[model samples]
Target chain A: MGWISDFLLLNDPTLRVVVPGVLLLCGMSAAVGCFTFLRKKSLIGDAVSHSVLPGICIAFILNGEKNIFYFLLGAMISGLASVLIIDYLTKSRFARNDTAIALMLSVFFGLGIVLLTYIQHQGNASQAGLDSFLFGKAASLNKDDLMIFGISSLLIFLLIAFLLRGFSLVSFDDSFAMSIGFPVVWLKSLLSVLTVWSIATGIQAVGVVLMAALLIAPALAARMWTNSIIKMLLLAGIFGMLSGYSGAFVSYALPQMPTGPWIVVMASVIAFGSLLLAPRKGLFSQIIERNNNEKKILQENILKIFYHIDEKSGETQKAVLQEDLLNQRSFSNRNMRKGLRILERKNYLSNHLGAWSLTSSGRVEAKRIVRLHRLWELYLQEYLHLDPDHVHDDAEAMEHVITPEIEAQLDVLLGNPTIDPHQTQIPSKDE
Target chain B: MNSNDLWIVFTAIAVALICALPGCFLVLRRMAMVGDAISHAVLPGIVIAYLLSGSRNTMYILPGAAAAGMLVTVLIEWLQKRLRVQSDASIGLVYTLLFAIGVILVTAFTAQTDLDQECVLYGEIAYVPFDMMSIVDGGFSAPRQLWIASGLLTVLIIVITLGYRGLYLSTFDPGYATAIGISVVFWHYILMSMVSLAAVVSFESVGAVLVVALLTGPPAIASLFAKRLPLMLLLACVFGVLACVFGYLIASFLNASISGSIAVVIGVLYAFSLVIKKIFF
Candidate 1:
């Protein structure tokens, strides 16, 4: 609690500088990252981050001072150069996109390292803090750095906010944007510039090695929760800001911990959590949905089996033994018993000793399933010119899926028929 | 040249050769970034292994780093296949997460040790000549990194020579390979494992970034000249060795990081090849 108050109150001078710097950096990077993610160019962010090292080193070597503005300019230039080279290499027949990306990333970073070691050997006093750009020194940021970051982040944010429509259009379908008379090329170049700008600015907070995570993780996590670009941008920003805050706090509490890795770890945790747990598209939820659908199909299949048995014997409510149900289909014994128990619990079936019979409501529901199956089979036979034997398997699959509206349409399309293509009496809806 | 210079060049050539061998297959399969990913992700495996074994022996660290590399490939596959994440995003996500964890582990526990974060990115290749291992009692000795690298290279060359057909078939036409009863999945994993091994072996001298440079740069440059697989592999190795020699020379002249100079030289060579292709071909 004491630490929490200290963190929240920003009692420490270092915390005051680091906390806002990280939040602004991460939030803007994430907001820009969504477009890159949508364009399926997320790895380009990684390449740009790595490529900025040489730019920073060159800026230092030339300026002979630790000017933040010159570093950003140099980083942005090299970052853009790397991106353009990757694009050209990918377009060429020789190298693939992945190869081009890896080539540019390692080579540029290597050059940066070369210059960096050279600078170290020269013993330049100002070159002491340049290596911090490699791994980030968030706590070392001063008021002037914060002012620069705040202004740049605000400009990028407002720019994105104003051109949201064109940006989304270019990301989703550039050709369509072009056809609609939008300046596709200009918009694309602007987007690339924005991407490089964000990476160059954010690199100092998270370092060259882990900067891509700040761009990608929040956007990816936000993507899992949304389909709209606006919502994704907002969610990604919030997620980024949250990770930034927590990462700064943790590094503050434990002075030994590095801030950049902690920030990446927090963002990754959020992204992985979203991937595994978000609704509908999430892995766990999809698995659960699939399991429930299978169970429903199994239960309906059991009901259809009972209805078929009743139809043959001309006894609407006759009880059937478990063996009778098992003999009709190839269902395993465990699944059959499980389905029967579940059906009975739902009052769809009444278990009498060792036998089971459909209840009144269950018979009605069972009748509808059978009717849909027969209707689909007849429709496939009459309209598709298929043999009666070929229609049953297809209808068997569709029977559990057809909604009531589709059932009526099929009934009307089939001319309210009472006889199926196999010359069996179709179950009437009212009955 | 002095013995130190000779020994450094030898180590660099060995590392470049080892990385370029598996790197050809990675490039052919268009999975070069996976090599990049594994190179970074092996860090945590290294730290955890060091913690458990409490030794810097290759016996402990190699397997740990190799295992970590395999985990990265498997996780990327799972994310792509099962979770339906796009391939690039998944690669970016998994490697960065693992790398972040590695950085954390290094800072938290290994701060007192020799394995610092900077060393992980930019390895101490120039210092390789100093860490000698005596093969005989008061007789012959060699740098420890050279012995480890040479042993790994021998193993790698033998594996590639023995498994050439399977590797060839799997990379070129996986469906046809499967039709002929060759297990595509098995060969894919085998190649990935070899890549992991190469990355781990090279991690000491060149560090992760330069390992990627060696892995991708040589093969990419070679593909412009060679069409056949064997020729491509030979050319890749040749270019890799050349890069090593030139990089070492440049590093000595500039008094800079050896691995970094090698990477820059590889880039220069790649550009040179591109220019050659434009003029001659």
Candidate 2:
């Protein structure tokens, strides 16, 4: 509690404003970043962030001081100019988008560095902290800066809310939005404007170097947990806020640490966590699903083996020997034992004296599987004109995935074929 | 020009030339951002090397940074291939995270060394002449950065000369190259190694930010004017030298950072070429 209180810097009046200001700035960046991430224009945010540096430097030079309004205006103009230039370069077929981004980012940032160096060379005291814009100076953010962050963040949220339909449509499908008369160009430009504005305003908190991380990481993390755009936006905003707060907390506790990089580090942690640990799209879930799928395929293959053996032996052998089953298809001892246990538990098979025989229910299920397989093979052979031999491999893969609806369609398409391409009898459903 | 001015100009040109060679391939493969990613991500490697070796040996720094460069590549591949993250998003994610880690490390160890964050971002190119390393007992000496830059530039020229056709073939069409018994992956790592080498060497003199300008800016300008690969490579060196000269002049007149001025000059040259190309074609 003592450290926390001290970190909030409650003794300093100016420090009171920095927290919410950072929260607002980061939240807005995350919100805007969602659209950029979805649009596959993450690097554009990077270019805009770098482009705004010269704008800040130029504003300082013009005013001989740090006027937030001039900084905003200059940054907005140059940021938009970078966007336009990139669009022009790509659209003109002169350079690819990546090329344009790298080109503009380096060029604009290089110019910014020049101006910043010039400012420093002039030995102006006001320009002393200006270089902090490269890596951000969140602790020094004053009340006026907070006001700008607050109002800009509010405006960004409001515009996103009001124009949700237009923005989503444009981001997802611009040509369709245009065909439906949604002023696609204007909406895209508006999105670009919003992106530039968020980056330009948020520069003081995260800086040009890691601003792209703030824009990208939270949105990417949010996307992992939800599929809905609105939910993603809300989640990204929350993630952004958490990152900002935690980052501020760290930088406050450790005076040597910069807030911008800490914020980025926090956001990346959240993103990596989400990627590896989320329930649906996460690595763990995907791994579990893959394992389950492999198990199901194995079980299905075991069932097919039983049906083939029973059919070939003409039901004369009530109990097939384990040795016979092993001779027909390869299954390891442990796997065979486990498969038997699963079959026995499901009432799909009965083992008597170390020999396996299918139960009545199991026989019916096995027949259905064999029927679908042969039907697909026949369908492929007849309609697609594939060689009977060639159809087996594809049908083998398709059998497990064929839905009940697809099975019925295949049945109708095959015209109730009684046998497969190899002339094996396709068991009837009533068998 | 005075000897001091000559050293500065020579260092800039050498750095620019080294970067421009490999940068041509990056631009062609549409992987310019990879160059940016590697440059940013190599910070931790350099820092880690410095921390471990407790010295600024080229042997330690270059290899360490190269390992970090490869880590960036591997991390980006994992995110894109395994995690299913979007390509650009992955690039953005990995570099920033590594760079942030580097920033924290650099800050934590500020008392132990003179390698501050500002120096990494905006290098003291103007002070390069002062940090001279004597070759002939101070009678004929060059900036240490100049020596490293020239050495790396020599290695770059040798490798490019030997592997030019292979790099060109694989970059243009990997599948066809592989069909013809060329190893695309070999060329990829080789190019990446070169990128890391250039990034680490140039960063000491020009800083990470302006080094990126040198890597991408000159090649970008050459790409605009030249269609053939040889011509592009040739023109990139020419543009790089031109940008260095003009940038030096501009910095002197304006009393600005030399590296920053070089970047600005690169931008101006690009715009000028853009206009000329647009008008003539």
Candidate 3:
């Protein structure tokens, strides 16, 4: 508690303003971003960012200073105009989406640069504040800016909460929404306007170049965890808050370090962590499961070897020579030893002359693994229309992992195929 | 208009016509930003030429600017092909870096007396009326930029018109053109160079920023109305000349900062054109 008080006293004004303000802005913007990401309109955020520059510049010139509301309104117009023009061109001509996006981004930024330079040459000191919009200077926030951020965030939050169902339906399947009389056009336009509003609000603090990342990264990071829309929104909000707060803190701890880039770095950290370690879909989890399953398969195969020898002679199969076991099947010596030890520990096999025979449970497990392998091959070849040569490889991988429910679905889909594509009979569970 | 004024107008339009001719072809290839890039990127070349000659010889300056323009094209193309950056991003990155480097070098190295960043960005089209076109026998009558711009424009038009079909096929679908044995890459370089040359000659007049407007806006506006490439080229040239005239008039009337205002006006005009298209369509 003393340390917390000391920390608050040290950063005095930062805690009151810049830090909280950025958190509010990044949070609201990222929530909006997740919707845009799902809608496949990510780089349109790029267009909005660049296009808003001229709006802000024009608004600054018109208002003779940084009047946030006027600047935001003016920016919203250009943002709408940019989207509408690109929309028109793409609709009317031979323009690819990338071309329209790239074109609008350059021309608008060029025009703004030209205007900005001209204004600078004119030597208006108020316009001096306009340079912050180029690369952003979030550390300079005051109470007024924070108030604007607070109100804007409140409004956006309300807008999202009130329209949650409509938004979800619109984002996931707009064509279906339209069929069901959801006024898709209005919803899209509303989203575009909100996007522009957030961009306009952000430009003075975080600038334009990094604003798109703020709009996209949090949601992208959140997406790695779950497919459920409600969870996605909540996780994205949390990630956004983490990035925003930590970025502000780092920038605070080290004087003169830019806030926006740190925010991006933190957000990317979360995105990368989720990419490699999220459950069910994370790289590490998948790799670990695959390793464990392979180990189980190896043990089962060794048990099968012991069972094969035991069934052949009916007495003292373990005393047979290892050479005889090698001739019976193409098992390597190292794998044969590992499998024999596992079976022996479980009391399923005794390798006296390196000829192993399985106990009852080991024989049953081996039969199940072989049955699954052949069943999947049957499913793929019959139901998937895959050729025999192609079916074997996929079946070979999926056989160890397919659950009973999946197998039941496969049975229903393939109508209980009795034979594999290679003319081998598929052993049923009962058999 | 007086007969002398008429003759000047004829010459000016004649020169502009040659320039506008190439502008048409460039407008089609969609290497419009290359013109903008070259126009700005030629400053180092000009500065270098002035350094070498210790004077602004049209001969030295033109080639110098052309060389610099070509260098920019090469840099942008290399960035595009080798790095696999998108052509648009490459254009933005290359031009900004070159323009900034030129500005910084000019400030850092030399006495801060002569040209500065604004002069480079805005150019001095207003003073073209003062530049004398001199020869051994012929007295200085015409502005030399007009003559050079017109001459280069003529060469550009002749080449483009001769290779117009090949160029059109290449622009519309390079894969199809390659299948048909067109040297798509060669024509692309030729087209890029022509834009570079056009930009070099016009660099002093329209300025660096507005040159982008001329190249992109006219073609884009022309495109809104025309379906055929030839018609689009013609309309683009007409729009280019109209923008110059109206831009000149508006700059004169407002007594505003001429070059910057002209660019703003062109932007406004492009927006108006978009609105018109939307309403009518």
Q: Which candidate tops lDDT?
A: 1
Which residue runs of candidate 3 sit more than 4 Å off their true CA positions? Answer: A1-11, A286-359, A373-398, A405-431, B1-281
Model 2 TM-score, all chains together: 0.95
User: Model 2, B57-108: lDDT tens per residue?
Assistant: 7788888988998899888989999989999899999999999998888898
Could you give the candidate ranking by lDDT, starting with the highest?
1, 2, 3
Ranking of all candidate structures by their DockQ, best first:
1, 2, 3
The sequence of per-residue lDDT tens digits that candidate 2 reaches over residues A124-236 is 99888888889999989998899989899889989999999999888788889999999988888999999999999888998888899999999999999999999999999
Worst 10 residues of 2 chain A by lDDT: A6-15
- On TM-score, the leading prediction is 1
lDDT of each: 0.92, 0.88, 0.67
Q: In terms of DockQ, which candidate is strongest?
A: 1
**DockQ of candidate 1 relative to the true structure:** 0.91
TM-score of chain A of each: 0.98, 0.93, 0.84
Q: What tens-digit string does per-residue lDDT give for candidate 3 at B1-281? A: 34333333333343334444555555556555466567667766767777777776667877777788888889877755643434544454455445544544554445532565445545666566566575556765666666777677778778878998788888888899999899998887777677666666666665565455555665666777888988877876776666555555555554443454445555566677878887997
True contacts kept of each: 0.93, 0.82, 0.03
The CAPRI-style docking tier of model 2 reads high
Clashes of 1: 0
